[model samples]
Target: MRELLITWGDGGGELAGRLVRELRAAVREGRLVAGERLPASRVLAAQLGVSRGVVVEAYEQLAAEGYLVGRQGSGTRVAAGVADGGARPPARVVETEPRYDLKPGTPDLGMFPRAAWAGAVRRALQGAENRDLGYRDPAGLPQLRRELAAYLGRVRAVVAEPERVMAINGVGQGLALLVQVLARRGRPRIAVEDPGSPGTLALLRAHGVRPIGVPVDEEGLRVGELAASGAQAVLVTPAHQYPTGVVLSARRRTELAAWARAGGLVVEDDYDAEFRYDREPLGAVQGLAPERTVYLGSLSKTLAPGLRLGWAVLPGRLAEDFRQAKQYADLGTGAIDQLAFAALLESGGYDRHLRTVRPRYRARRDALAEALRTHLPQARLQGVAAGLHLYADLPADTDEQAVADAAARRGVRVATVGPGRLAPGGPALALGCAGLPEQRLREAAALLGEAVREAGGTVREAGGAVRDVGGLGGAVS
Candidate 1:
């Protein structure tokens, strides 16, 4: 048998401990098979230039750990029933990369301000106190909280104070924490916008909260339906509704505020409210009823989602409980990242970054709208005034999934509105316009038009003449 190989670095544990670890690894990795006899203590000790006592100690330890078996006449052998760590599980099937990706819930990752972020990180680290690096308040860094409170108040008209801000991983984590708090408070049911974010619905269900779906229309979430659902709490994306991109009208905002004033809880998800093209985005619903609303915001849309940095502006009543939940959920977010973001906000770098990317995104959105109008004049587009994506309502008879699949085959990917819908609705597609360039977006829209036509949708000419297309079969050019 080959001599046992052991790495004994300086200050690595005792020689016997090292030998025991090596042998146990060998057995677990299947390098040493079951019933394989190890070299005698004396022989191994001589080969490894260690004392025989050290080898004996290691062997005894391995035997105690059930990694080895010793017999009176036979030498120590690898034990049976040991799992092989080297064995691999079946490989996961990977999907092909689409030529044009138009899925929602993602921004242009290429627009991340790497240089400015790196600078902020460096400055934060250099200026940080020793205590700042240690265990921090579960609520978040004080400086970051202050910056977030000020920034939100200024940008989104959110009524916030530093004390009420809780640093969180993202809106997803914030929602989870809110669900936990609500369940404890005996309010276990929450109303969400119908055809809202399916991810949010699944997340609430995962946390044991029953989500009641309320209908949404051109005016936004139907407050009348929400009231009828008998849910005391409701989650809304008011500044810009998801998938549909409709801004809540002034009348609905007043009604929602009235609902909150009458003792309903409002959980406002202020996602992607900073990218309105025609005018400035509206103030948050939380600003109207600060004491009754829990406002959540994240950098996932503005910055890269990979940062996982976000904040929650809570009502005074739920602040402590949410902070405790955050504490227990990974001892709060990373301090370095919090400090870096705070510095960026303080230095006005974040606003500048937004200013730079806003027009670029708007250009992409325009290109997509124009492309859809040019290629598929029959499709009606909505939610184009704000947000990173647009909702294209197809003909009622069009098969949404079939169109999505046909588009995929043509190397153009889109998100179907089916999964996001809780109630039966018209067929539509949510196409993201933030990830690709203007020209690529035009190409994707042209391909999507072809897919729709192939999936039995009517194609209308610019002069409004309808032409019927055949079923899906021929390949897209």
Candidate 2:
């Protein structure tokens, strides 16, 4: 048919053979539906600028393959069941677009340094050798590794060498590979913060690693509970805890390092460590216990998650195994992107970008905090010292899920802490401040306050008992 696409330049196959392939593809791909008649051989030949005999040959072959049926009077038509076999599932219905997306773990994507990054990309490509385009060391390009080692050391206080770093797709891949390595080493169980990342839990589960949930307090993951859990390894976001956004206290950091030093392993996810507001900068725990820590960092929050650029600084003992895992898992990350990021880091463009956006994100965070205080006066906010999202503990009587649903109905989307909790916890919401502007965040907070008020009464009347409300520290009202 005229609608069918055929590529004549797809190699040395005969025209009729190519026609057969195209027509077969069209039928299999649902382009030629069941009972749909194709043009006459002569007509199709004219339309395709081919000989009539070629068209006839293709038609004959397809007909014999049961893709078409022909009769003396009715001419050619698609076979009755052909299209059903090739039919695709209907597309998923997209959810309603929320007025404000307060979902955590996302940055203000519009602030990405497009020009600077583009320049870095251009320079990287121009400076790259022909061999650079081919498969590189699974650990990463030496240039990028060297740059990362220097950058991490100077910025995050991570004790890393180029040999100890392996470029990964993101923290997700790094974690997955580490899980696989641990499994091989007979350590398949890792302790995670109870109110930790649900995505992290799911990822660990997918990799066949059992995640033990340890409670998190204002000081961050409870080292006492983690030690009691008997998990040989632990995954933590020390710089800024997710959902809660609490930093690991100095005391807890010391205890954690001691635990790791005593035959334990720590996997530190240094996500969103770049944006610190209203607090003195705390270096990564890996800096304290590099020999027992696998420090993971990514550009997901700083630049864009779409870039999928990240690195893992592994302990010397695990470096070679992790490198092999990385080699087997997609043969290292994209070279061009790696080189581009390296150039950006070396040129200090990355630091400049962080400096530029830090103030803007801080402003948004301040606006959200102020709006929440003004609107939901009774709600206690926690972990606002650093990171893009703040944890808001709802009134004991409030229903967080109901509030989230009410906010969604009001065109504002927010995440509840239920999905992330391994044990029972009081109702709370994690509101992201980086995605929207200050004005929008204020508006969203107001709407959220209204939703909380509307949902509060219903939950109170239901007599739902609050559970596991002890560990989280005193509210910062």
Candidate 3:
């Protein structure tokens, strides 16, 4: 009862009144609990540097208001019901601890190379100079940009020079910065893949830029549709598309390059390019059209998302504008994290880690396919060649959301493929298999089967070698 938090407001009002208001607010805000004994008046008065009479007056007022009760020799206690304040309105959505989480694009966090990362960070600190500790080039730490340029060029065959590369917090920050740059340059409408990363579309719209949807097929973005979309700029995931897991085909790549050459700008999101299971992943589209494409890649998928590290390799002309935007974004990303990432890249530690983790994800992908085949034979799976998840098409009549909700109840979580600004096809499911143990993957698939049947829909396999279903509707402008 000796410790009480009381802030003495401006001496505009009586000290006792200010104390009473603050105490009531503390209880209402749950900072003070019911039935908890408060400090003696003299004790609180001394702590708050106020007079004992003021404390007594505050306590007396609060007691009259039923906010305090003085028990025999028990000192002053908060009233049992005073702390509740009032009943709160129901929340719009109540999040529960999920039994089985299958959210898309989520990596196996447990597999993060903590030892290597810590070692890299330690080395970075040991090597950092005093000047490196100060505010640096808004583009990024010079060492990191140089390392990134070389790493990207050797691995993805990108035409990146250190001078044109900018380190960002993550791909999201890079996108925001690029959007600002483009909007200033009179390009506000960007065509995105239909059913793309809805977060990307939302980011654009939130910043007053319009995102037009261009449908993507088995090969990837329909360049013809993009050209006709009347958008001056476009964003794409060429190595591996999101939700649907298709690579941009070579012919369409040529068309996209040509379109970019004809005064259009392309922003490439090279996320999850490290996890391709089939073969050496395709080179970045920026390599084919370096003059017009800006390539964005991040460590969120490979390393822990908490690192918040990524980079953008821009066309030389666009690099300066991006640097200015980056400067204004946060002054710059942290120097410690940047130098640490540079150490990781220069020491060949990053390559060694990729070698260790790639096979693990590949095995998980295989397990997902097997589980789906055994349990939900009626469902068609696509996008299994790479990335962390698969796109599943259930029987035509199934209610996607109902099935997902039912699966959630069965201790398995699944997500319905969002329609985004365009409906790619029938209601689709995006199921992530990474991080889940083999047994859980099988169990999740079984749960999906049960959920579908429970939704009053029959499970019949699609009648075809593969289900490259046609568009459910036209492109969304």
The C-alpha lDDT values of all candidates are 0.85, 0.85, 0.82
Off by over 4 Å in 3: 1-95, 458-477
lDDT of 2 by residue, 323-342 (tens): 99999989989999999999
Clashes of 3: 0
- Say what the RMSD of model 2 is: 6.0
Between prediction 2 and prediction 3, the one with superior TM-score is 2
Residue 132 local lDDT, model 1:
93
Q: List the residue pairs that clash in candidate 3.
A: none
lDDT of 2 at 224: 96
lDDT (Cα, 0-100) at 112 in candidate 2: 94
Tens digits of per-residue lDDT for model 3, 106-165: 688998889988999999999999888899999999999999999999999999889999
How many residue pairs of model 2 clash at the backbone? 0
Alpha-carbon deviation at 152 in model 3, angstroms = 0.1
